[model samples]
Target: MNRRDPRVVRRLSSLRRRRLAFVVRETAARVTRILLIALGVLILLAGAVLTPLPGHVGLPLLVLGLMVVLRNSFQARRRFIRWQKRHPKLIFPIRRLMRREPEILLVAWQQLLRSEKVVLRRPGWRVLKRGRKAVRKALGKTPLS
Candidate 1:
């Protein structure tokens, strides 16, 4: 539906592909970090129980594990900031889109509801209610108090 120049379309598509790849890489890095941390803990426990292995080995493993965790945390934070900058929609596009196609409002709602950041058993209800209210206000509806 976007009748833009071919070059523009190509650029946009490439950017989207790159962003998706980055997200996948970020997720993989996080998984690797968790596994490394777990392995480090296990190594530490083994070092404690088994007197044969030098304490130095376990200390290095723990240090490496902490480094991996820190690296992943830093990368994730940077990626989040980059994503926010590159995809402003992730933060504020709902209001703009709601003005154009009110019917697609439910799509946005569904996205927020199904977000991984929303812990379903915890404060999810509160977040959902707040999201709904925000969306409703964006759509120019009289929001429920």
Candidate 2:
């Protein structure tokens, strides 16, 4: 017997829908990258047969594939940043909750490593600095062991 607020349920449903859409878009981007890479490979192969045309056409095709890959990479990164922004409070405690448990820590670390936002590093560094400041204020300069 789970008692849940209707409004909360609705909000969760909305969030889930948005997340699904993001996942679909991300998947599409990845598929596009693969298609572009395949296209570039085909173009380069065709250019090999065509000689001088390859230098002109193959180069641009390769560049186009590279650009598509980079664009998809950036979009994933932006989505990660947006997710982190939406879920800041979940970060620190989630870390702390896993600290003592090595298995959990390893799993969490792997997930974090996979995250585009976490790969950025600088934002995480800033978050850590802020956390340290807050801890110092709360505990009066107690050195973290």
Candidate 3:
């Protein structure tokens, strides 16, 4: 069935009809964007947790989260583009990995291996550990991402 009622459309003034439709559209878009951002964050956190698992679900989930956020968030999209520009070596492998082709994983691994610099992201974890210990001594939980 067609959702919009013809009688309702005919009854409203042209400008009022436009405004009502505009308001509904804006509200829907706002809700959708917020939901997408929340979902993206949840996916990203899950990915981080899954990263060290034996089967290795982390990268794909992380990339998926990134794509969701980039699609809904202008700032995130800009930042990701900037980051890609800054780390050209990392971008190709990530793009290949996100393609979801069976043989691409090996290609991505090779691309990563051929890169000159290995990026170790342990510093943040170390700092978080220190903070957690400090917060434990203070009898408070450290809410870190």
Candidate 4:
């Protein structure tokens, strides 16, 4: 209980020490994220540079950079997911190839079937498509297709 006691000083300093530790942790996390993002960008640039050099490291470096960036970044992950959803036919095959699986063949076949265009008789098809676009334009709506 005496002011001169070491235990008293330690007890008084504990709250300030915890606050300092919390601030350090938060600052460290921000710095780590920045570093990771920078590292990922540098790696991607390296991969791009390697692409025309006739080596096998380019694609692997690219994937590694992508993984690191995505793992560290919520914004990048969201954007990537949106892009993937918009282009599954393109994304699916790449995903399969990355996994070293032959399932991409099946995915290609599925996409081929799904993409088979039908130009035949639907009397109002043009009217519907055009009308939808016109109405969407009038309403200022985003295009889904």
Q: Report the number of the highest-TM-score candidate.
A: 3
Error of 4 at 27 (Å): 0.9
lDDT against the true structure, per candidate, is: 0.60, 0.57, 0.75, 0.74
Cα RMSD (angstroms) for every candidate in the order listed: 22.4, 21.9, 17.0, 13.0
Task: Arrange candidates, best TM-score first.
Answer: 3, 4, 2, 1
- The C-alpha stretches of model 4 lying farther than 4 A from their native spots are 1-12, 93-145
lDDT, model 2: 0.57
Question: What overall lDDT, based on C-alpha atoms, would model 3 receive against the true structure?
Answer: 0.75
Q: TM-score for candidate 4, please give it.
A: 0.58
Write one digit per residue (lDDT tens) for candidate 2, span 33-141: 7776566556646545554652436433433443344344666447545765889655443334323443554544545544635555676555544665687989888
Clashes of 2: 0
Worst 10 residues of 3 by lDDT: 112-121
**Model 3 TM-score, all chains together:** 0.62
Q: Write the residue-wise lDDT of candidate 4 on 1-145 in tens digits.
A: 6988999899879978999999999999999998998899899889888867886688667766877788788998898789899998666655664564446456555554444424524545544456657999999998888
TM-score of 2: 0.37
How close is every model to the real structure, measured as TM-score? 0.35, 0.37, 0.62, 0.58
lDDT of 3 at 26: 100
> 7-103 in candidate 3: lDDT tens per residue?
6656566768899999999999999999999999899999999999988689779888977887899998888789889998667666666564635
Q: lDDT tens string, model 1, 14-118?
A: 999999999999999878877865675565465455545655454334334433443446664476467758887563443333243443456546566657345
